[model samples]
Target: MKILCISDQIDPLIYSNTIKDRFSDMDLVLSAGDLPLDYLEFIVTTLNKPLLFVFGNHNLKELPFYRHSFEDRFRFYSPQEERDALTSGAIHVGSKIHREGNLIVMGLGGSLRYNNGPNQFTNRQMNFEILKLVPRLLFNKLVYGRFLDILLTHAPPLGIHDKEDPCHRGFKAFLWFMRLFKPRFLIHGHIHLYDLQDVRTTKYHETQVINAYSHYIIDTGAAS
Candidate 1:
């Protein structure tokens, strides 16, 4: 299956009329974080595909809309609620496990705690968040023969694609998650790559870590 992953910045190629023609064959859309809701809405309306996303440290004005009710933690938005939220039918999968067909994806959206800010978490907090998903992941392993297929986040894993700065530094818990659950992909967005030569994709153990700075296309062998 073909998936379109976007984050951090808005790409003209995706925000234009030509987007339909450009990515018409994509089976799914995943947003790593830090993108405007309107940009995500446009993609949802244009592509008319399943768009699952997490919240980054920035551009999260609509975050509250996705969390208006505590029940949102267990259920997806109804059709009317989705329209009312004005996210153009996109779904926020932050800190949740979402299953699309046979693909299992878990999201942990936030940056390393550097200051008082929304969507920022300390390493211990992030680890606790992961612990919350243990029961579900274990169930998935028994039923599907794997814990997860994708580990989606706003920050990269420590020492992989992360920087030395506190804000941009990745979570050490993510490395532990990989060692345990062994997801096929750990896709994140936080550090912006300016130079073309800067690395964006790396392989660590059984997972492929990717930086979805602007946009990227991933072709997975899994069924849609």
Candidate 2:
């Protein structure tokens, strides 16, 4: 399967209406976050493929360039909400487990709580958020006979692609999640990279951690 993964910055290549001609061959789309709602909506509408995304820390901030037509400053919906509050036409996978065809995906959005912003979490808060997914993961293991194929998040896992700052620091809980669940791929965004030589992908246990800052393509050979 050919999957297009996007995050952080908006790529003119994908944002252009020509996205259909360029990415028409993609099987699915996964967003790591920090993108405008319009950008996401455009991809979902134009490409006409399954899109799942987690919320970045910036989604809640009031940016001068962003449209205020959205209901509130927040962009992501809670797990308890019946409908998605986000304007993006794609499905939100944050704090949830969703199965797309033969692939199993789990989402954990947000970054370290540097301030009192939404989608930001402290170490304990992030751990608690991860705990909410345990029941679902256990059920998947017991019933579906699988654990996870991808773990989607806004921030990278600790000691992986994360930085030292409080705002960009990776969640320590994510390391535990990867170690426990052993997902084939743990994809994230947040720590932006401008240099080509900077590390992007790393191996952790049986999983491959990818930093999808702007955009990336992944070919999951077979549905495992």
Best by TM-score: 1
Q: Count backbone overlaps in model 1.
A: 0
Tens-digit per-residue lDDT, 1-224, candidate 2: 88999999999999896998899999889999888666788999999898998888886442212323344445553543413345557877888899998898998887888986767778898899788888988998998787888999999988898888888888889888888989999999998999999999999998999999889999988652
Model 1, 65-159: lDDT tens digits are 66453544675656675565664577888989999877899999989999968778899999999999999999999999999999999999999
Runs of candidate 1 exceeding 4 Å displacement: 67-87
Tell me the lDDT of candidate 1. Answer: 0.89
Taking all chains together, each candidate's TM-score versus the true structure is 0.91, 0.87
- As a whole number from 0 to 100, the lDDT of residue 8 in candidate 2 is 98
